[model samples]
Each structure stands twice: as C-alpha cells, then as structure tokens.
Target: MRPARLSVVTATTVAVAALATVTGCTAKSDSTAGDGAVQVIAKDDACEVSKTEFPSGHVELAVENKGSKVTEVYLLFPDDRIVTERENIGPGTKAKITAEVKAGSYEIACKPGMKGKGIRQKVTVTGGTAAKRSPEMDAAVAAYRTYVQEQADETLPKVKVFTDAVRAGNIEAAKKAYAPSRIGWERTEPVAESFGDIDPKVDTRADGLEAGQKWTGWHRLEKELWQDKKLGADAKTLADELDKDLLDWQKRVGRAEITPTSMANGAKELLDEVASGKVTGEEERYSHTDLVDFKANVEGAEKSFELLKPVAQKNEPALVTELDKQFAALNTLLDKYRDGADSYEFTSYEKVTKAQRKELSDGVNALAEPLSKLAAAVVK
Candidate 1:
C-alpha cells in the first residue's frame, strides 16, 4: 500500500506557499542556531516551535525529532490546508524545511507517529509583499498544471478497466489491470492529494485509513484478488466505489492549486514516496508491482525537473548538473528490472534482494537531496 498523501481544501491564498518538503530537505536556524530559521523540536507528546511568528516570504523550519517513532511536521493554513510538510523523520534526527508564505495565520503540526491530526501550534506571519517570481517560474507552473491535467485525464479510463475486471470477478484480469491503472495516478499523486477529500477515497491503503473510514479503493481489491484468491461479497461494490472516486478525481483535478514551488516540491515528494514505500517493498506487498510505481514516481519527478530546468540551471548550474547525473543513474538502474526498454513489466519486488533494495534506496536519496533544493532554486 502507498503512503497516503493527505487531501487538502482549496485555500485561495496559501496556494503560493505550497513548498512541500521531505526529511533532510529543509534548513533554518534561530537562537539555537543561525540563518534566521525557526527551530522546531518534535517530541513524543509535545511539539515546540522557537518562534510563534515570523515575516512573510521565505521561511525555514529546523525540525529535530526527539521522539522514538518517525514523525512528520507540517505548516498549515487556518482551515488546516497544508502549506508545506516534511515526513519520515526518524528518531534523534534533524531536518530543515523551507517555505514561501504570504502574511497570514498558520499552524505548525507535528505528528509523532506520522498519523492523525497531530499536535498543533499556532503561528503568525507578519506583513510583507509576496515574492515576485521570474517569468520562467510562471511558465513552469503553467506547464505543470497542464501535465497534471493530462495525467488525471489518462488515469480515469485505466482505473475503469481495472474496476471492470473486478466487477466481472475475473481475478487474473483485474490483477493484470492493476499496475497499469496506477501509472497516471502515481505520476501526479500530489495534485490528486490536494483535493482535500479525494485521495483517501481512491488510493488509500488499509493501514492508512482513519477512524471509521471504510476499506476501499485499489488496495482493497488487490487484497481480495491476490491474498484471498476469491472475490469477496463486497468486491464488486468496492470496484464501483473506486471507479466513482477516481472519476471525482478526474473532474476535480484541473481546479487544484498549482505553483512553481509546488511543482518542484511535489517532485521531491514523489522521490520521498519511492524511498519510503516503493523501495521498501511496502507499497505493493500483495502484487509485488512496486517497480512499476517506482518508475512512475521517477518519471513524474523528472518531468517537473525538466520543466523547471531552464530557471534552476540559471540559479544553480551545479545543482542541475548533479540532478541530471543522479536521474540518469537511477533510470539506468530501474531499466534492469523491466522486460524491455518501453515495458512496465518488471521483476516482482519479492524476488529483489536486500542489496538491490538498498541500492535503489541510495539512488532515490541521492536524487532527492538535489531535488529538494529545486523549489528554493526556482523561487530565487
């Protein structure tokens, strides 16, 4: 099952601040450090921020997880729309988060177990004009929006094919459709996640569900087809529900908020997803189709980086060069698992050795480090 990206409401104003982050990607300092960054200490029960307020424009959060469990920290708008977030911070580790916020009221939430609403701390951003972005950045955002829309458009029909097989009780056919159905969704997950209500209804895993939430969507059907080896009484109903939910996603995707920073940040989020779930073999435990999802995530990240390359190369040529090299290295590694150059057919994840997994993890981390800085580079 995938690590579910939280859905968010439309926050007309905070759209510009959607600088998503992952562990080890953000930087800031304050009294305890330097560089005008706010300090965040995340404990098992308490979340502490060094400052309750700061100026608008660029802000950094320096987060240290003192908790035993892995934690996630988020910057959220008043209605809890996520402005930016960093996930998968291990115990005793520190990470930095950078965001571009307009003057407004916000909250910092730290989820110790990386679940639920989390502990919230109110924050205020003092008045300042919004950052004036380069035309290239605007062009990148426009292009990314188009890309996201195209992905959404392409995903719905594939999902329908999978659902149709399920409703027909053809387990083998449904299994065949599963991995292909997810490619488009995997490629633009963050955009689907921003709808505030759609993702949980469609892509959520069994473990990722909240209290009172029903088990539905792709994973639920996957379990019935692969693990149970028979159609559950509810299988057809679940398939219909999955089809309906993804239809909702296809309709609502074009309205999602998009920004240059969001595109860059989202690219990093995809890498983080691969590192956390796909490489670990947690996302597709039943089908062992993790490699297909891994490829899609990398493709998504690469698309975003390519769109913003012109501006990022100008601001940090060395970073862009390193990013290109790492991406090539990772793609070459992935190609080894595929049936052919253009096929999604891959060796099952269960057949992969521990060493191979580690190598994949290392490659993702390598690419992620440079991708993490893409948002800051483009916005500059």
Candidate 2:
C-alpha cells in the first residue's frame, strides 16, 4: 500500500456523518461428486474454501478448524436454505458433510457463537450432469480478486500514516487519518474495539515525545501503570489519575469502526429489485421511503470521504482517486429523482420530469457500473 496524498484544499471542508446502506446475503449449495475435490478451512472467523467454482449435485465438503477456538460452519443456499451444517468443531478438529444442491447461488459462512458475523464466500453452481467451468465465472472471479487487492492496497498505506502520526505525537494528523483506516474495522464493532485503549486529548498533544508522556494511541504505557489503582492520594494526583480513564473512553469512541456491509446490502437489494422489474408497482416501488434510503447512502459515503479527507489527502492517493470516482457516480444517481419524490412508486415516465428520470436512471447505472465490476469480483 502506498501513502495517500492529502489535498490541503479539500481537508478543511470535510465533514463526517453516518451515510449509506450496506448490502449482501449468505447462502450455500450442493457440490457434484467426482468433480475433483473441494476442501474448506475455517480460522480466525474466516473461511478458506477450496475451488471457487462448484458443480450442482451432492458434493463432499471437508472443513478443518485450525484456530484455538470452537467454530461452526454452514453451507447456505439462496432463499435461506442450509445445505449442510457443522457445529462446535473444536480446535484442531475436522468435519465432513455431503449435500445435494441445484444451480444458482450459495454462500459458505463460518460463524462462532451464532453471532451473525462471519466470513462469507459466494458460490455458483451450474446445471447439468457434467461439471464445467464457465468463462464468465472465471472472469468474475478474476475481477473480484482484483477488487479485493485494490482495497487492500488502498487501505494499508493510509493505516501506516495514521500509525506513524500517532507515534510522532501528531494528534491532528492521527485524527484525520483515523476515519478510513477504521471504516472496515468499525463494521465489526465490539471485536474491533478490543484493539487498544486511546486517549484523545492528552494523547493528541505534541508533548508525547517526552519520556514521561501521557498515554496516546493504542496500548500506551499508562494503562499498565494505572491498572493497579495505586497511583496517588491527593486531589490533584487523583484527578490526574481519573483523567486517564476519561481519555481511555474517548479513545475507544474515536477509533470505533462501523461495518459498511449493512448499508451496501440495502442499496444492492433495492437496486436488484429495480433491475428485475418485480418492483413495478408505482405506489410501492417508488415510495418516498426508497428515496430517503438512497439519499442516506449518498450522505453516508460523503461523510466517509469527509472524515478521511485529511489523511486521505496526504497518505492514500489511490483511495482518494477511487473515492472521487465513487462520488461522481453517486451524484449522478441522485440527480435522477425529485428531492423527495417516491422513486419506487413512480408509475410511468410522465410522473417525473424527463430530465430527472434520465438522471436517476443514468445515476443508478453509473453507480452500478463500477459497483458491478467490484461486486462481480467479490460476490463470486
């Protein structure tokens, strides 16, 4: 990952807020016999499935647990069907199962404690007796791999800049860099919260370089010092001691990461409906509710851009570049409908201004263009 270049002009104007709807689904399907072999491993709340492609029918699945904790894995099909399931596969254990499935889409989820959080791998099973790989599938997988690589490339360098700023006692820089660096982690909330204890105020100060400096970012020395609760006696000393706790709380909030999956999922679901033509009823399809959600997604993405502007300008040029494209795509989408018009409930082209409808259609298509490329890569 390379450092993102920060634009000074844009930094000062950035604003942060919750925006966008996350979207996605989980499902599984059967595998064909004698289709070579399929093996999947579950570890660290993720599933490493063998063979991105699957043939329809009864396929054997072998799952192994390498992590220390107990884990459960499920093979899911579309329509909320579970093709196969294995629970409480303890550390160093393995389980094998077989199931018959039809073609369409599927997902493999390895979850622990039924937390509704886990790694999901999308799978596609083709029809027919002979197992064959489609060229389109191959292209989609390649594209998805590229997308993941791009995101990783875009994220790490910015993270390094944020970490470096913290180490250098550059509080303002660190704060600016925190947003995008923490976006993915935030999606996992409680799990991401355990990463560290941070103090925003004292930690943000420039004096952090001094030998006896107050705690700053993640695991600063103060946490160990005050854990015993034997620091001081006088009011001034006790006040200083209490300040650490306060700072710790602030740090937690500052570094929190909210997962974007839900927002993405919501947007995709609505768009899928529009594409399929099932949502044709003007009253139900173009409801004001749909427009509100679309607006919210746009606003959310803007907020994300705002929060990361400072750091993004300086540390992650690629992300900034990609973001600009994303923004343009979204703006184009929003121009399609009246500010508060019920897009879903839109009965005919005449209901809204032609220009507005064209903008909306174009915007949706524009957003979907990049997203489809990106999605094709990930939702294999």
Candidate 3:
C-alpha cells in the first residue's frame, strides 16, 4: 500500500500510486519534445492543455508541474476511468504519458495536493482507431491476464487460512499466516488496484485513511495482532469483512483491462511501491514483514519484465541487457536476507540496518531508471 505522505523528488519523479499503473507513462524531469506530444501545464489551481482535440491513436501527454505542491495528472474516460496517469510529480518537474486512445470524449485532471476530485479539462479524441497490436503483443497481454488470475486464485486460500485463524481467536496461527497471506496481493497490486474501489477496503493503512473514512483492512487487523497483542470481537468481525472483500476481488479479476503497455508500466509501479512503502518500513510497522513484501514486489516486477523480454529484446536490446543486469543485482542483494534457497522466510525489516536499507533503496532506483523506459520500448 502507498503512504498518504508525499516525498519530495529532486531530479525525476515516477508514479507512486497504484492507480497510476493503468497505461504507458514515464516520469522524467526534462520536457524534451520533438515528437507530436500534447503539452499539459499544471499550476496549483489551474490545468492547461496545449490542445483539447486530437485524432484517436497513440496519444502522448507531456505533463509539466509548475505548481507548488506535488501534483498528479490523469487521462480519464468520461466515467472517470483512469486511462493513464503520472503521480508524485513534484514542483517544477515533468512527466510523459503515452496511451492507446479510441475515439471518445475524455477529461484531463490535475490534482495539486494529490487529493480530491482535481481540476478537470475536457478533451476529445476525434476519429482513427487505436493502433492494431502485433500477435506477439497480443500474446503478451493474454499471458499476463492468466498470470494475474493465477495470483488471485492462489491468494484466496492463503487469505482464508489467515482469516480462519483470526475467526478462531488463534493469534499465534494468525500471525504466522499474515505475511504469507499478503504475498499474492502484494505481487499483483496494480491489477487489483485497477478496480479502484476494492483496494481501500482490503489494504488501506490507518495513516492513509481519508477524512471521515473508517479504517478497516489488513493493516487494522495487523495493528491488533502485533501492536495490541490480542484479538477481540471487532478483530474477528474485521477478518470476515476482509475475506468478503477478497472474494469480490476474485470474482472480478477476469474483467480487468490489460494491455502490453499497462504490463510494462505496472512493473515499474511495483518498484515504486517498494521505494515508497516497503523500504521505508512504513507498510508493515506492526508485523515487521516488510522484507517479505519487498521480495514479492521485486518478484512481481521481474515477472512482467521477463514476459515482455522477447519484444523488448527485439526493440531495445541494450535496455534488456541493462535490466537483466540490474534485476539480478537487486535479487542477489535481496537473497542475502532469505532464510533458505527456496524459502519465503526473510529477516525482519527491524533487523535490517539503516545502511542496508539505503543499499536496497539504491538498488531499486538503479533498476527503476531503465525499467521506466520499458513501456516506450514495447510500444515500438
């Protein structure tokens, strides 16, 4: 889960929110434009677009934040479905988003504090269809869909185990099942988050709660099991709620919108998840299972990269090589904390030193730089 707190970015900014994983978007500081990309200038209260109408096809939005606060820019369908977005764009920074657009009416929203229903601007995509995809790209999309469904299928039973222990008032058993229960969800979070409504119910942390919003999710139960050190009637009831929410997720996984660029963008989003929450020790404050979640994020990112490697190799061989090198390096570093060769058990995040966390953070940044270009490469 992403923290509600915003971090300042110095050079370049990548998306940190789960909803930002929808389409092809890359975060960069420089606004170098030679290609036909629309310029979007975002101020604290106003959002200005270079053009409101463009032909429907491969559309690109170069977003520049002139605002004082960290901002988020979204390409939304009329119904507010996020087609693509770039979040955590710090003051004076820039980001670029490339999306597959069909002829339709849409909105451009600029959210200054990264909160509320943002300032909206109407945009119309006139006539041509979204560019046709190659069979290889179609195969990639289909494979990724199956992979997401598999993760959802695997997650249900694990979550059931944890919830059953909670319902039975077995604190020790529940604690044992906690981290393992979250592995599948953490791995494919962007896909689950695409549903929008499901995420806050199942994963919202106390600090991340909105105004007047009740805190009821895994983290709430996490606080009870670890911080309070006891399970009560409320905890039992929450376990049931959590189970019901996840069951809904399982039923809806098949309907999620999946695209080749979305997969690549999503891989980078998982790394952003690590940098924002897992490495900071904020995600698992009560349980200290941050390492388990950290490893799962990397694994998930690697899965997407690996699936798209064939197309990426054909288009950007150098990028594939560098990604290969960096992914191996990061995995090697993570392996240092594993309890066994094939085990999910990891050294608690509390035991990891500050210096070690920095090393891990550096490793993530190293890989993220190249992985950020994956979407552009695949679309080539």
Candidate 4:
C-alpha cells in the first residue's frame, strides 16, 4: 500500500456543538440509490472494482465500506479537483455522491482510516453521454470562484504594501497594513487551504510552528511590529517572501471548483476555525486582532451560505430562512465592535469581554446547526 499524500485531521470537542461528529468520523448515508448511482464496495485491502469506463452526465458513485475502519472515497479530475466525494463511511454502511461530470479521464481513490491512499482506479468517460448542468450548482460555483478571484486580486497589492512597510522599517504602517491584508486571505481561505504549502505561510500561528521550521507570515510580523515594537531584517525578508507567495496565488484565478458539498464543508470549516482559534484568541495572540480574523471567517462562511441558499431553499425553505436570520444576527452581533468604515478596524481581542466572546461563540454554533443540513439538502 502506498502512503497517501494527505494527513488525518481530527476534530475537537468544540465541534460537537455544530456537528454530531467531526468531518472524518463515521457517517452512514441513508440516501436512496438513484438510477445513475454506481455501487463500489470497499474492503480491507482493495476496492471491489477498478479501471472502469463510463458515460458522462449526472454521475453518481455509491461507495460502501465493508472494512472495519472508517473509509472515504474520492472521484477526482486530472487537475486535482475533487469532482465528487463521500467521506466518513463507517464499516457496513454506504453513501452516495452525485455530480454533473463531463467527458474526461478521472480517478477514484479509497482511503482507509481516512489517512493513506487505499487504492486508486482510472475512469474514462466517453463523449457520447451529453454533459449535464444544474443552474443552481453552476451559479454557486461561479459565485465562489468570482469571490476567490476578487480576493486574490485584492491580496496582490495589499501584500506588497505590507512587505514594503516591513522593508522600510515602518512598524506603524506595517501594523496598519497587516489586519486588512489578512481579510482577503481569510475570506478566500477555503481555496488557500487547498494549497497546503501556501496556507501555513500565509497564516501560520506562532505557537503551532513545527520544530526547526522558522515562523513567518502574519503572526511573525505581528510580533515584530506590535510586541517587540521593532521590525528586523529577517522580518523584512519574510515579508517579501510572503508577498511573492500571495502574487503567485493571484495567478491561479479560476483554478478551483466550488461544488455545493465543498461549500457546505467550507462553511463548516470556517466556523470551526472561529470556535477553535478566533474565540479562543489563539490566532492573533500577539496583536489581539482575533476579532478581525473572526469577522473575515464569518464573511467567508456567510458567502458560502449565500451562494447555496437558493438550492437549500428549494428543499428546506424554513431552515434556509432561519439560517439567514441566524447569520444576520451573528453579523449584527459582531458589528458592535466595528470602529472604522474604510479602515476595517475593530475592538482588540483582549478588550472583548468574556460574555461578548460567549455571544459570538453562541452565534457561530447557532448558525452551524442549520448550516450543517445544507450539504445533504443541496447535494440531492
């Protein structure tokens, strides 16, 4: 068995408030098998079937886990875009993932323990089957892509400003440029997170640095500019490196896909960040700008929700409305600390009372309740 390129991520106790189990935990699907759904059984060693060819259109892959451990299946395109995926398949249960696919060569991967790659099979889809499209799904993906592109566009220039300030030893200007610069990064975090190497450089927390890996990026600059009140030569070089990374990311506009399942999971991931990092004040420990990151996370998650609201409304209208209201309420609650219009300033993290932080935490969990149901409702 070849080692998988992916790492196992475990969710914490905080996630229980929003999700019954964290993402990788076992989840059995109770969905009815559609006519287009293909059943693929997973066992202890290999996938039951492999290297199959199929016609395209509305393609559904029903993956059943007969293995003792939790497993997941991914249908991926050549460019590394995940077209469809079913995760958390416990032993003796099955789940289905449906996607509108086109004529292309794809790969199916089964991951046992949700860790290393179990097995992979190639799939060749011929052009005879017409490509199918869904207006709702298309619109949602387009919106998310546009949002990512816009953020990338904005990030290019902001990063330069921050880097230049650091080079010039302008602590005040660098500090000013830091929080707002992070907004665009945070808003498009789902895509940023896709590139594992870049994400840590863009937003690595100071305390979480691996042994021997030098800490850089926003938090590193945060310490130099705020805590030490000095910007050193090393920090300046890091600033330039960070700027380069952001511009390189800018060039990848429209490269990623924005499926409903991804959006649903992205929203949940953003809130998980809030619960684990923002509310805990661990993300911006040096500068106490956790509120800024919190706002951007909410904005990102809210954008996902807004994009998929139409589809969710069609299936669960009341839940959609309540989700909207909850989101709005959460935004309203966060707005109390807003101190600047164009400046994007907010009350410092330390200044926010424990009660107010609790309110924010409560708001996130509230939104997560209805938001969790969105993927299942829209995927069908």
- Candidate 4 structure quality by residue, lDDT tens digits, 1-380: 00122322232334221322322222223243345465566766666432256677656677789899777677766544456555556899876555566788766667776655335555667776754336987899888888889988987788788888889888888888888788888776767665445665667765555445567677778888888988776986898888877777787657765566777766766776787678888888888888888889889889988898888888889888898899899989888988877546899889998998898889988987677666666765
lDDT of 3 at 196: 61
Clashes found in each candidate (C-alpha, N, C closer than 3 A): 6, 47, 0, 0
Candidate 2, 184-226: lDDT as tens digits: 2222222112222222222222222333344333223222222
lDDT for 379 in candidate 4 is 64
- Model 4 clashes, total count: 0
Pairwise TM-score winner, candidates 3 and 4: 3
- TM-score, per-candidate, Cα-based: 0.89, 0.26, 0.88, 0.70
TM-score of 3: 0.88
Model 2 residue 372 distance off true place after TM-score fit, in angstroms: 40
Q: Please give the RMSD of candidate 1 to the true structure.
A: 5.3
Q: Positional deviation of 283 in candidate 4, in angstroms?
A: 0.8
Worst 10 residues of 2 by lDDT: 1-10
Cα lDDT, all candidates: 0.81, 0.41, 0.81, 0.71
User: What value does the lDDT take at residue 356 in candidate 1?
Assistant: 91
- Candidate 1, residues 1-380, lDDT tens digits: the string is 23543434333443212321212222223466466788998988777777777888777788899989899888887766567777788999988777778898887888888777676666789987786778887888888888988998888888888989988988899999999999999998767765557777877788888877787888888888888999999988998898888888888777776777778778888888898889998888889999999999999999999999999999999999999999999999999888755589999999999999999999999999888888878866
